[model samples]
Target chain A: MENLDEKFNETIKMGLEIVKETEEDRLMTLSVGPQHPGSGHFRFTIKVDGDYIVYCDPDPGYVHRGEEKMCEYRNYIQNIPHLERPVIHDSTNITYSYSLAVEELTNIQVPLRGQYIRALASELNRQVYTLYWLGIYGIFLGHSTMFMWPLGDRELFIDLLEALTGARVTHAFNIPGGVRNDMPEGFKDRCLRQVAYFEKRLVEYEDIFYNNPLFRQRTEGVGILTKEDAIKLGVTGSVLRASGIPFDVRKAEPYDIYNEIDFKVQYMKTGDSFARSMVPFLDMRESCQIIRTLLDKMPQSGEVRAKLQPNPKGPAGESYKRVESGRGALGYYIVSDGTPKPYRVKLSVGSFRNILALPYLLIGSKLADMPSIYWSLNYWPVEADR
Target chain B: MSSNQSNTQNGSEQKEKVSESVQTSLSKKTETITLEFESSIVNHLVTRFTDKVVQVVYVRPGRTKILVPPNEIVQVATFLKDTLKFDHAESVSGTDYPKDNQIEVIYHLSSYSDEKLSSHVLALSTRVDRNDSRMPTLIDVFKSTEYHERETFEMLGVYFEGHPRNERFLLPEDWADIPPLRKEFRIKGR
Candidate 1:
């Protein structure tokens, strides 16, 4: 008993020294920001008093290239490549909303095959985006193995996407009318095989990362958000779902082929870091099911692209469209005055809304819990700033 | 004296019957109220506050738009939050109309508590003066409008009265040009 007590005291001392408290008079202010590895291109000034965050001020816009302002200068088609640059990894979904909004504005009809292919690309991109976020989330928690596995597996999806769209990273596939082109020969069989293989690897991830006791101890019950607070604060996507509110834009407002596709909205009631992590993990599993179904139901052959004039202009009106991107609900609002270029374009992304809860969640929590909470919110800085 | 006692007893019985009838009518009234509001969100807004809501248009199947005057925006937002259960504001966007010399601000409100209302989007819009763009803030009604209100203020220069912080959110500290979304502020060489 004496030896056990001594060992326990040693563990306690090590934990205390890890998160050192400052002097009462000396409150430390930290800029976890533009230069920091944890924070992306964004910067947030946090004032810590004795290892507890007293105040936090998030400073976004380090990567803002004035995408909305630039949209007014380019015609409809030229804007696709430029718009996809903001969130390059999640390029398909970003352009997907723009295409849907533009389609409503211009009154263009997409072929059924085109719509199915668009949904397929969206599901594939969703996996890539989530995997990229998971990789970053892993590294933030000092789990290097978790970081490498997702990135290494990510290459498989990228290779498949490259075959479909002829580009690996930024596939400027979805235009205003439809996708740039159709699927290549034998693409369906290759896609199904790769997706099925990826699904098997997901089980391995469960064994190594999620089921590990260390990972669970660090994440569970940390940075909890109540259901009332979640809805009152206007958070969307997985963060809201984690709080037990099943408000997925895909389930609530079905765009494209989401209504026809059979799948479930993965959610959790814990509203903590663990819940946030699990929601995306389950979502990746569901994406596999969606991709398989989309492949099976897709039309064999049809016109993928609707031919338009050199520059496509719309009627004098406005349209608002939103899609469930990897981060959250991505909405595009476009106003046109019967001109080739849009009069005003507003891109409301999920990262910005999700980040609003940071200061609320950060205050009074231990500084050690910062990375677990921040990254689990699935914030992408470039996308937020854009 | 005996006749007076009989009259008092009869009066008490009549009072109990009237109270019971009132209870039944009250429940019926509430049932109609819920059905009326639930029948169509657009119709509820149109009938509840006819004067404040200028013109209600059904933009699409899931979207219902209501155009309100700038001053009455607060009133409309409050009614939507309290009477109806539209709990959250999704997006707050401002459009610069240089040709008409006005700027339009639109707020997309949806509900989370009410499952039926969750599927729909209520777009509340109001026009403000272009040069002196000022409108009452809806953050008090819906807390989620806080960040969006700041974005609109910085982007289109539409000053939201009574917002806690109207400072630069997405822009640089030394941004000196006119609001970037305005029509007069042209991009370089555009």
Candidate 2:
């Protein structure tokens, strides 16, 4: 009886606390958005001293779909497509990598051909995501032309994805053993077209965004994180690489067809928004090369999903898998107890890593620069809140 | 970086590249392959290493898990930074191994050098006295431990000893009850 009351009291307290806001001295407490174009699906309570943010408390949970807990409740095989929902743009990469690791743990094998296809699809998605990030960062800095270019051009690949996977955003193609949909007919030509098309656009992107003085003024030296500080803050993905650490999991520890592909690990030493800008740009170029290589050199025929007696949950065990997402290195730590559902599931979301360091970084910067800094780092609120 | 290759007695020229161990600039490391390393032997090996004072403990297998006591964590982390030179903490994760009545804080550390690709993960583990749940703050050693530790404190209710600020890092301040991260903290009734 005492325990029940104690638990009940605790719940009520938590319920109230979630609604509470900071009482920072405010000339006017400006609410950024629940639907503002600046924020995707979240709100920020900023105490503004004229044009500068005196204090910024991010009001998350607007997009909290309970992604982590939902993963726990879902079955082993059911979780394949679900985990990718937060960052639907990078669906194949995160889902495929996670399924691969989980399959590895339960002693399932995805066939060599499947591995190559998975790699191919992931690389393709990486290019699309990079362009989207660049576009978002462009608009964040007030350049609409930069935003429209990539968003418009991104369709060609989306078409390629639709033809192959039957869905543009939710490419639940990856199954436990292998992909649900195999490469369709004429995919090679269409894929090659976009791949070649991107080859030309890659330089144009450099000319328009990277070389543009205005973009540099907004991005370059904006979020300068030193090598030591980058490590300290636990920043991952492009943010870490932008600090000039060539730590790409694909290169460091190869998974799928990464070992066979020959490509350079791209990084920028400046550790600023400009440096952050270069990551997706260079990455997209490298991905284009990888897609071409994988397509040209892929084996004629082999199995896709590994042969496993049963895809049922393995004995009580745990597995941690980190794969490069559009934002950074996304890790999924899953624990099982010989049951249908997971005993625990914790998503080490990529954007959340960059999001947590905001108060420290945004403390003294001008309020106007917040949007640029946010977009340049490429934080997806749904992914972060997940 | 020096690579140590042991000669194959039967040289069929099959070409299997095997190294006994590779040198990673001032530190010699052999891949553990999987997460499972015998705790007692690893402890013995830690004592044998010269130049650097560090300890590696296996927390769990199949998962990249490790465990380290607070006393050894500071020394080992310092050695990893100054001696072996792993300057980055990639992820700071917390686990409530309630069966063992212990909480594990895992720091995934890596080097900036290209030659050293495989991360040398060392687990820092301390079991809080269940009733008196407390462990010294690791924020002093690894600065990033502050946020992770606070999250752990909020979720698992594992008391952090001498934490610079025990204030909420993730959850709201006025929230009630102990953290909900403990493995045994059953949600059935709630």
Candidate 3:
């Protein structure tokens, strides 16, 4: 009778301990949501112990539009406008890859002058995209001035793109055969002048943003992605370059006169948020030189667009083409079944690959460093979700 | 500059023509194709997976396609990652071949550490049973392939075995329609 009574008391004590553990919570869950300022069209659930984040789960796809599925419905050329919408700010480069893929499937060749012009617009769009990314990165880390300057400076390129392509953001300039049109009359002199002034503006950016002690303290050593971790996780663009890899798709797989144009691949070994931010800055400087060279070396006059059938189709085959966009290597895989519409169109975006590094980089880091680490990966939520 | 050669399947000839024209106009630099050396990496892969690979073709410049049986994909991927040092997967793409009643999953693997391998993109593909579409995941061999496998899971409904998280990523939680990327999943009002 005494033993039975003791067993009952022990069971009650165990129940009480379970209740106590539930009442005294150690980790707090925070849902950085779809509408949050720091998180862009995406949500992530992070478990925090005080200020330190213990766990993180990135919830992407708030903007999934079934782009691959939709590609089947539209003919090849008609899909350009919708495809570019994923990363509309970096529209040219995204369309550049698509055009290259479509060209491969349909066996269309982009002219020498057309290739140079395409590369020029791509470089210009890179500047626009990077500047916009820098602005958002700045605001994410609570620096108002850094945010304002890049946004204002971005207009210089946007104005140039508007003149060259007519549309500011969604240029729809890249087509399967070649670019839609050639460089506008007297575009060279204006582009050069603005590019030179932009070089001076870059110095101002370095002075205010890169060298700022407060910004450095928050980003310099925080969120360090080692060389091995970076390659293993397959982070691309600035994130991979920041981790000390000199694998730029432009130099690695030169397409559309990238090999002909001379420029150094900008990379850094530090692999921190600061390094991630600085590589794009250095790339902007390199892009200015590339633009000048492209202008100087471009053919005097030639055909820009190759004439194609109303509905271009080719033999059954598959082709994949990649371009070095503002964010790493953006690739398009096209499968043609001798039809006007594609059998399949798979867009392998850099934003999607780069965003995979989040959970690895975010865990065990301070909650305050979340925005700094997240934005440093150069992940565009809309592109990634697509 | 406009030539009938432009519409040929392998546009390398046109690319060369364009390169030559650029050189002639500039009269400053020599235009040379740097991909000659990178093709050897594909040669090495062929030698390694001779019996395993059902077909191997240089689909285009800097792009190689290797087709293998679904059962042998993991083995071939291990050889590429460990021996050939194709460090990371660039992309995982799926093509639904309804006529054949199979789903082709292609893993585009490349390297950042090895300069030669870095320049080459190897498209390793295998066709799995459409009705019972399942294949072993390569996440263990290449960490970068985790999310891509998850994407293939929801998009084409290819079940990647051994993947930790195979839940819906881009689709809604309550979505029960057939995977949208399949050949027959037609968009409404098209």
Tens digits of per-residue lDDT, candidate 3, A1-386, equal: 99999999999999998877552288899999799988899999999988988888888889999888888888899999999989999999999999988887777877888998889999999999999999999988888988999999899999999998999899999889888888888999999999999999999999988999999999999999999999999889999999999989999988878888889999999999889989999999999999999999999999988898999887777888899999999999888888899889899899999988888888888999999999998889999988
Clashing pairs in 3: none
The residue-by-residue lDDT of candidate 2 on B1-190, one tens digit each, is 1211222222212111111121111112323443223232233324333213233322333222334565566656675566555565555555666677666666655555424424334333444555556667766666666555665676667667778766655555466756656655444543
Clashing pairs in 2: A109-A306, A110-A306, A111-A304, B59-B66, B68-B125, B155-B181
> What's the TM-score of chain A alone for every prediction?
0.93, 0.88, 0.96
**Which 10 residues in a row give candidate 2 chain A its minimum summed lDDT?**
A19-28
Who is ahead in TM-score, 2 or 3? 3
Stretches > 4 Å off in candidate 2? A1-36, A42-62, A307-311, B1-45, B48-64, B70-72, B97-102, B113-120, B129-131, B164-190
**Per-residue lDDT for B23-116 in model 1, tens only?**
1112455444443333356545554554334465433456667789998889888989987889988889999988899999999888889887
Please list the residue runs of candidate 3 whose C-alpha ends up more than 4 Å from where it truly belongs after superposition: A1-16, A22-24, B1-43, B50-54, B57-59
Q: What is the alpha-carbon interface RMSD for each candidate?
A: 5.8, 5.3, 3.3
Model 3: per-residue Cα lDDT over B1-190, one tens digit each: 2322333433443334323322111112221354344444544554454434535544345666778887778888888888888999889989999999999999988899899767678899999999999999999999999889999999999999889998888888888899989988878776
**DockQ scores for all the models shown?**
0.30, 0.21, 0.42
Better of 2 and 3 by lDDT: 3
RMSD of every prediction: 11.8, 11.4, 7.3
Q: By TM-score, how accurate is candidate 2?
A: 0.79
Task: Summarize candidate 1's per-residue lDDT along A1-386 as a digit string, tens digits.
Answer: 99999999999999988777647446789889888989989899998987899889898889978899999998888899999988999999999999999988887778888999999999999999999999999999989989999999999999989999999989999987778889999999999999989999999999989998989999999999999999899898889889999878888888877889888999899999999998999999999999999999998999887878787887787888899999889989898999999988989888988888889888888899999999999898898888
